[model samples]
Target chain A: MNALRNAALVAVVAVAIVLQAVVLRYVSVDGVVPNLALVLVVVVAVSRGSQFAAVFGFGAGLLLDLAPPADHVAGRWALALVVVGYLAGRVRQDARESPVASVLLVGAMSFVGTSVFALSGVLLQDGALPVDLTLRVLAISVLWDLMLAPFVVPPLLRLVDRLGSDEVAAARPVSLARTS
Target chain B: MRRRRFGQGPTHDGSRRVLGLLVLAALTVITLDARAGDGSPIDPARAAVGSLFGPVESTTAAVTRPFADAISSFRTNKSLRGDVATLAAENSRLRGEVSTDPLDRQRLAELDGLTRTAAETGYSLVGARVIAIGPVQSFTRSVTIDVGTSSGVTKNMTVLNNDGLVGRVVQATSSTATVLLIVDTESVVGARLGTNSEIGFLRGRGSIADSGRLDLELVDNAVVPSGGDVVVTWGSQNGVPYVAGIPIGRVESVVSSPRQSSRIAVIVPFVDFSALDVVGVVVPQGTTGDRPVISTPTGKADR
Candidate 1:
């Protein structure tokens, strides 16, 4: 069961990454696509604990870094997402309890994740990061992520709840009852 | 409380330790990749991932294209209808032109405008479609095309669409190649003014916003560039990156700076980097054997 759930988690993240890389570009506004992979990482963090979220974040970040058309350094996204996953997981209990808090957490983590990535770019002198352009990208990316959260988070949360271990299901009888 | 039951999952100390280890691992990978440059050990991993996801991206792009077209058509209904009429008329005109050029008729059947441009410019082209785009997580403007070394495409080859220059091939796998768009900040192409042939360097501003413009700075300060002056590639040695006489863009506006002696002009590139679909990679024609020798009428052929 654990192996099945882990495989499901990997499949979900992979699908999110592929969607973000391919399909999301068509719906982009001003070249800013929503960070769907980041949202998934945050959701995983909220449902699981920091340890699981960090591992998932690292793997997902590595995929984003290595994905084609990615010209930047390999570990920038990995670092940014690791931090996002850890921080998001710290508030797991509150986010799991309240839908509003979870949505807010997604928005906040989006900002942090983008900021971390941008800061790394600035430090590494990766590309042209003009103040105005960077700020515009940051603002628009956050808005896009927030807009995507309501539609994505709840369903993903329910799915993750279903994928939870038997021990977790036993511990959280309320969620199991709701699912039933 | 209920917290004790859930606390059995992972201890706080364990999670914190894991976070630190992962963070350290990421930083180490970043340093190694940054230091290694082109020969980074990560290249193999990147290529593997690209190959794995390449098919998925192409499939998704194909599947979603119609829905995308529908949404865009809804937004620009009137303009798109007019555009269709204009395109139909242009297609007929282009067909007429292609028929007149008997030698290029067969090859020019696909992407007529692009093939025509290549034929006129005396370049052999291999056509490819953009399979995927650079993720927004990174601010680089690049696209992965569906052609690579298998299609005779190599690094530093010029890519263009019907309008004009798109970019150059930066990386190529067997089945896919990555083209860095000319609008990327890292892109710099040598250019020549169509009017006076003033030498200059054009740099990308990294965004297609405000009409996908480029920055052109002349090597000489005396020549004043007026608005609407056409620009073409200056051509590199052996034409590895950009060939001579390919239309780049027109000077949209010039920005004069007192601190710098060189004059700067803003150019709007002909290629729409945003809606790129079919593009052609300019492949060099191979030499056919040895040069022909002419016989002289004089007694020993000038031996």
Candidate 2:
């Protein structure tokens, strides 16, 4: 049962990463696309414990980092998302986050996650990475991620809840009760 | 008051252990990939993963592209309709004057000018479709195009649409290439104003909202390009990066100070960088036939 659930999570993450790399790019505004993968990682982190979030984030991030058209050094996103997933997971699973609150959290996490990704590139002295560019990107990215949250997060949470009912119920009985 | 329970359940301790292991694994991967230098141990894994996902993405893109195109066309339809009306009116008026001597001379001169501009550039074009734009988090003003080495695309080639300059190729794989847009803060282009034929440097502000406008600076203190003056590339020696006579932008406003030797102007680029779709790359002239180069005429007074 655990193995099946884990496989489901991996499949979901894989599909999300592909959509992010390929599909969502078509709708970019001013070279800014919503960080769908980051939002998914955050949702998983907030609903599940840090442990599951961290592992899931690392896997998702690795796939993203390895994806084609990825210019930065490999594992940059993995490292960034791991930190994001862990931090998001630390916010007690049972605590109720209102819709606005969840959106705000996703927005903040997107900014922080992007910062970590850019900072890692900068630290590696990737000469192309500039501080001002990073800041500008962070600002626009946060808005894009926030805009996507209301649409993406609820559906994803519902799917996860439906697919892995036993674990989700064990993790947050209150959320299960509310949804049911 | 009810208390919040954190990390409860049967596998709590095991979860902590997994988290630690994951973190360590991520750190290790970052290190290994970074230090690998010219060759990466993980490139094959990445390539394999990319291959696995590529087909699905292509299929999805192929399936949904028409809807995306329809939406985009709908958004631009009104503006396009307005342009069509204006052009039709101008064409009718021009047709009425074809028999007049002065109008004939003026039209001939305009044709000559366009011919000279194209001849001066001496470029071979390769057309490509934009596949993906940069993610907002990367803050990189770039786009990936479907054509790459297979289509004779190489790094540093100038890219443009019908409107004007779009960007330059930064990286190229066998099947695709990434273009660094003119709006990227790091991009710098040598430009000449239409009014005085004065040359200057154009730099991007790198703002997502302000990307449509670039900063034109380094003009001689004595010559200030007026508002609406056209800007074009100065072209590099042998046209390695940018060819001469490609339209860039028009001056929006100018700023000057007596203390400084150079004047600054704001230019609104002709290309709509935000809405790029199909673009042409100015690749090297093929060896079979060399293009004839013509000297472009000097600047005319601003209208």
Candidate 3:
């Protein structure tokens, strides 16, 4: 059972990483590319509960930051993901009734999170992104999350439940293994 | 990396527990490396991953470029077609007309004389094409060009497009050379404002393409600056990286900053960089192999 659970978690995250890496303009609205990995992290974190979500989110963020173009502080992503994971864990049960609702919530959260990240980057660096580009990024990112939810959320939830009743407890050790 | 099994225990820190631990680890690394600048960029692990992914990104970009163009075409086909027609009409008109204005003819004559005089100087011109750019580059802009040391394009050579000064070559590999553009926040060049001949350093403020302005800080803001004012690089001791008069940019706007000694201006570059296919590289009189000179925003923070 533990082995199956571990494999399931690994596969989900591995797929997300590959998608983020290989795809460009995965969903385009106004020439902007939305970051789908962020959406996935939010969804998985919220639906699967916190423990698993935070760990997986941090791992994902670390990989995302490792990309050459990334300019954040070494663990900026880890910190962001950790917070998102915790936020997802604390979301009320009434709000996450349906997949579409969950996706919308996740997408909104991703947009806000990305804006915060951008602001943080600007404070650290000298240049500022134009106001329009910033807005476009948020809008397009939300659109992508909404568009990709059908594909991302159900499988994530199934995998989590299949892992065990201790949706939060069984999540840790297995995620760590896949991360390594 | 062994995973600790909590044995299905109920604990609130379930993930925060581990996250706190990771955060602690990351803080340790950041604190240790905050003072170490050079070591941060040379991380072998990070380099290996970036290199591995860079080519993949290139291939993807190459494949998607056509699609992107197609999308662009879809959005403004009519306006582009109209512009083409208007340009064709203007070209025909210029070919058919002969200007008889004495002042205009005299100005043309003087430009011709200046060109001839400039031609008398024996100088080598190296042409190159710009390639990719590092994503993280902002304040200290660096661009890769096709020309290299092999093509007589050495370090410290100035790069120019049809409009004005583009940048100076910093380093060269076998087939490629890196240039630090004038828009880089760190680059500072001696510049004269318009016909005023007011000399000051024109520094690169990095490209914020969306803003449609280049950051240029002048020595003084006391002089009234309106649009259409030209900025040129002031001649150095001996001709090399830049000649006596190369038009760099036009003043787009002038505004005051609360803390700085000078007022900053937005400079619109003469060259349309997006379509740049060729750049001229001029070898300065004495090239010191572009000694590890720091771009302003780069090394000074520590000092």
On TM-score, the leading prediction is: 1
lDDT of 1 by residue, B85-197 (tens): 34334444444343333323423543777757766777767778787787545778888887767667778999888788899998777777889988888899999999999
Candidate 1, residues A105-148, lDDT tens digits: the string is 99999999999998998888776558888888888888878877
lDDT of 3 by residue, B142-210 (tens): 555655655556556777765577777755554456677766555677888876877777765455243
DockQ (C-alpha based) per candidate is 0.41, 0.32, 0.15
**lDDT score, candidate 1, position A128:** 53
- Extract clashing residue pairs from model 2: none
Give the runs in model 3 whose Cα sits over 4 Å from its true position: A1-32, A46-49, A89-97, A122-180, B1-11, B25-34, B77-210, B223-226, B232-248, B257-261, B270-303
Of the candidates numbered 1 and 2, which has the greater DockQ value? 1
lDDT digits (tens) for residues B194-258 of candidate 2: 76788989987664444467889955767868889999988898676777788998888887766
- Which CAPRI quality tier does the interface of model 1 achieve? acceptable
Q: Which candidate's DockQ is highest?
A: 1
What's every prediction's RMSD, in angstroms?
8.5, 10.2, 12.7
Of the true interface contacts, each candidate retains a share of 0.61, 0.50, 0.15
lDDT of each: 0.78, 0.69, 0.54
Q: After superposition, how far is residue A57 of candidate 3 from its true place, in Å?
A: 2.9
lDDT string for model 2 (A59-85, tens) is 889987766556556787898898888
Model 3 DockQ class: incorrect
Per-residue lDDT of model 3, residues A42-61, tens digit only = 76665566676677677666
Model 2, CA-based lDDT: 0.69
On TM-score, the stronger of 1 and 2 is 1
